[model samples]
Target: MHYNHYGREPVQLGVGLLNEPCASAAELGQRCAAAGLVLSRAPTTADLASVTEFLARWRAVVECVERTGRAALLNDLLAEYASAPRLTDHAGDGWHLHFRDPGVATDRQIAALVTVGTALHLTGLGMDRLGVCAADGCTRVYADTSRNGRQRFCSPACANRSAVRRHRAGRAAR
Candidate 1:
């Protein structure tokens, strides 16, 4: 299933941030730019702190085993971090939706983007699409953008390692 840019990109960005967080505000700005977000200004220390807190909450959404609990967590985040949706051509590129008001702080903008994007992703794809890696000793997160939606590992390497481990375990048992 083909996913929209808004649905996929921000979730991936959220995953990236959760897995390997930024150490500083400059790094956060660089990472956001690398993720293709258009920044109105440089990130501040306060932005870094706020984003860290938001990502911790986002991690709850990822790790929630129950769909209802996950939805509740995300709903709370949406209430706190996101604003009423409005159409904007802020960059004059074309009309698009903005979940937060204009001229907000960088951290607030990111929170809105990732929160709304995650909601779109879950609703558009499946509630079970976001998950933690199944490979042993690896707790990384992943968004299941695959057509089959059976992805369990964060990377092919983890999958292969898991398969090999299972194979060896089976052989030893036999």
Candidate 2:
């Protein structure tokens, strides 16, 4: 089956980008290549700096969920991050929708996908599904793809750590 571009892949990529940042433009290019996005324009040192700056804005949107704002907040965030839609099928992979134009700077591309993809994710799933990990000292964002929609950690390790902490507390109380 054809993978859904607007689904988990984008979300995972967003988290991956947030979790591990590239120190330089070359590193950014390497990470993007590893993440499997074909760059339409050549990325430069400025592009990497811009991308890092953009990530800060994106993280604010994630933080908004701490207040448990409605989907409107997410929509507003998306609007601030994205531009007016201009469809392009640049790769000829098929006539698919692109919220931004091709051959733009890497920072612009990252912002576009992250903002729009995040909007689709929250709206398509639910607004409460995205947030930082609940485990102590862990501030990672989670996509929450579990069947019960109860995921609160960025990984199983955090989950286990939290669970073990809870178990120890319970035993001590008993």
Candidate 3:
């Protein structure tokens, strides 16, 4: 099951944002750039605030356990943040779909990008692909881009820790 960059990268960005929040617009801009997002300009304080609020909403979609509820939340986000999809050659990178209007504010652009990307991810993969880490005391979120789609922990370290804990508990019980 191959997933496009649109379906994968933005969800990763959302997870990154939720786990390690940005302290300033500059940091947010830097993070986006690091994630391969091209911003027209540096993010401002207002952009930072708006992105933070949007991430809070995006987190709900991630935390939703029911498939229907997750879809509904993502639909709400798509309606609120995204525009009609259109193909564009923006940046001369090649023709591709844009879920937002061109020349929007930086924050609005980020909102639209992340929202639409998440929608594509869930629909293309599975509704259960997004989740919080199952490791004890680890609250990180993850988008399961694995081929088998059975990811439960946010990382291999967390998975190992969880397995060790379970093994220890079983031994103790025995």
Writing each residue's lDDT as its tens digit, candidate 2 over 82-129 gives 667765557777655667665666778766777787777777777767
As for TM-score, the candidate ahead, 2 or 3, is: 3
Name the lDDT value of residue 166 in candidate 1.
98
Residue 50 lDDT (model 1): 94
* Tens digits of per-residue lDDT for model 1, 58-173: 99999996999999999999999888888877777777777888898899888888898899989988999999999999989998899988989999999999999999999999
Query: What is the C-alpha RMSD, rounded to one decimal, of candidate 3?
Result: 2.2
User: What Cα-based lDDT does every candidate model obtain?
Assistant: 0.88, 0.72, 0.88
Enumerate residue pairs that collide in model 3. Answer: none
How high is the lDDT of residue 172 in model 1?
A: 100
Clashes of each: 0, 0, 0
Write the residue-wise lDDT of candidate 3 on 1-174 in tens digits: 322436677788889999999999999999988878877779999999999999999999999999998989989989988998888776776777778888889998888878988988888898898999999899999999999999999999999999999999999999
Candidate ordering by lDDT (highest first): 1, 3, 2
Candidate 2 local Cα displacement, residue 64, angstroms: 2.0
How far is 14's C-alpha from truth in model 1 (Å)?
Answer: 0.4
Error of 1 at 17 (Å): 0.5
**For every candidate, C-alpha RMSD to the true structure in Å:** 2.3, 2.3, 2.2
Q: After superposition, how far is residue 118 of candidate 2 from its true place, in Å?
A: 0.5
TM-score of 1: 0.95
